[model samples]
Target: MGLKYKYESTSRRDTKELARNVRPGDRLYVIHDVSQVVAPLEDAQLYSEFIVTKDKAPFTGTPMVCSASAHRQVGGTSVTSLLVRYGEVYTERPVGIRNIAEEPPLLPEFQHLAARVAREHAADVAVARSEAASSGRRRWF
Candidate 1:
């Protein structure tokens, strides 16, 4: 099973209520797969020129907005309710794209990177064992 970190929405809807309702250790499945139509960024020309011209752009590089909806699952199958976690909110204008990379890092990606390193180490050990077996040498582990 794939593991994912939970992100709570700042919306004042019932989903936020559910998050608040759940007790610590209560099993909760986060369902995040709903598509809402958003305006394409490529079609946005009003602020594009300024962003391209300015050295220190204030706006987010993404022209298209994304509407992210979240849901809570009580059991393995049932969706308890829906909530709006992230709306298509725009960032401050005129900001450069580089600024996004400079922002604080996400914890989930860091954990994933560490896990990948561990898997690589394990694979290396397995390869060494296979080589030792073929060469008539005892494997040291």
Candidate 2:
């Protein structure tokens, strides 16, 4: 079965097309009215003093928007930044693909979102596995 797409409006279709056309190397600056904090992944053993500057060297990465708002490869590790909601982008400290499976910041406000992100990831995995299994022929004895 195929998922039904609502192309009822031209604007929606155009936006979809635009997203489809984004390349991996395209630069998308994740800017906000003020600077934002970036979270480091586990084992980075780095300090948490890093922040995405609003003036220079802003948070930037390849257009791999999904689990993370942007992604960049640093020091051979996969660093992914989660940009959820406005100005809430999580980076892997200095560089590297930040593993989203890791927890968010320890702030009381963001603690609640950690569980939700985990659940969403789990659901995505389950759905993908089911889809793959459903595509195969069933065997009955």
Candidate 3:
């Protein structure tokens, strides 16, 4: 079974409602445009196509505006009912479809963290080696 999707236009409140339903490990793929839609990558084998609107948007560098990044047990089958959890009126519709990455991009902060860790490890090893040489003991493990 391929991935299943439900398209809808969501406001900030609607987005929050959706986010609340997400569990700790469900993957939510969000496609953003003038309107936005979210697809939960859960139970694709029992998936059904939900057709609410037909539209398209420009394909830019990143198609995602938000992601739940976790699994959720939502309590509705229709877009209207799903978004209505937070009393939001469904007004937006799906614009277009695109592929989202399985892994998050390696942000600059993470890169910096990796570099710092490597540097610190190297420094610790150097200190250990110096202390060993200064003494009459030498061991390489």
Pick by TM-score: 1 or 3, better one:
3
**Residue 43 in candidate 3 has what lDDT?**
20
Candidate 1 lDDT over 1-141, as tens digits, reads: 221233244544433444334332233322222233453322222221101111211342211111111133212111122223232112233333222212334367587997899999999999999999999999788
**For all candidates, what are the clash counts?**
10, 6, 6
Model 3, global lDDT: 0.39
- Over 1-141, each residue of candidate 3 has an lDDT whose tens digit, in order, gives 222344234555444444333333333333323222343432221211222221212332111212222243332233334344323322222233333323434667588998899999999989889999999689684
List pairs with backbone clashes in candidate 1. 41-63, 41-64, 57-94, 57-95, 58-93, 58-94, 58-95, 59-93, 59-94, 59-95
Q: How high is the CA lDDT of each candidate model?
A: 0.35, 0.36, 0.39
Better of 2 and 3 by lDDT: 3
Write down the RMSD of candidate 1 (Cα, Å). Answer: 19.9
Among all candidates shown, the one with the greatest lDDT: 3
Q: Write the per-residue lDDT of candidate 2 for residues 26-134, one digit (tens) a residue.
A: 3322222322334233343322222222221134432344322325322221113222222222222335433334454576766789879989989987777777779
lDDT ranking from best candidate downward: 3, 2, 1
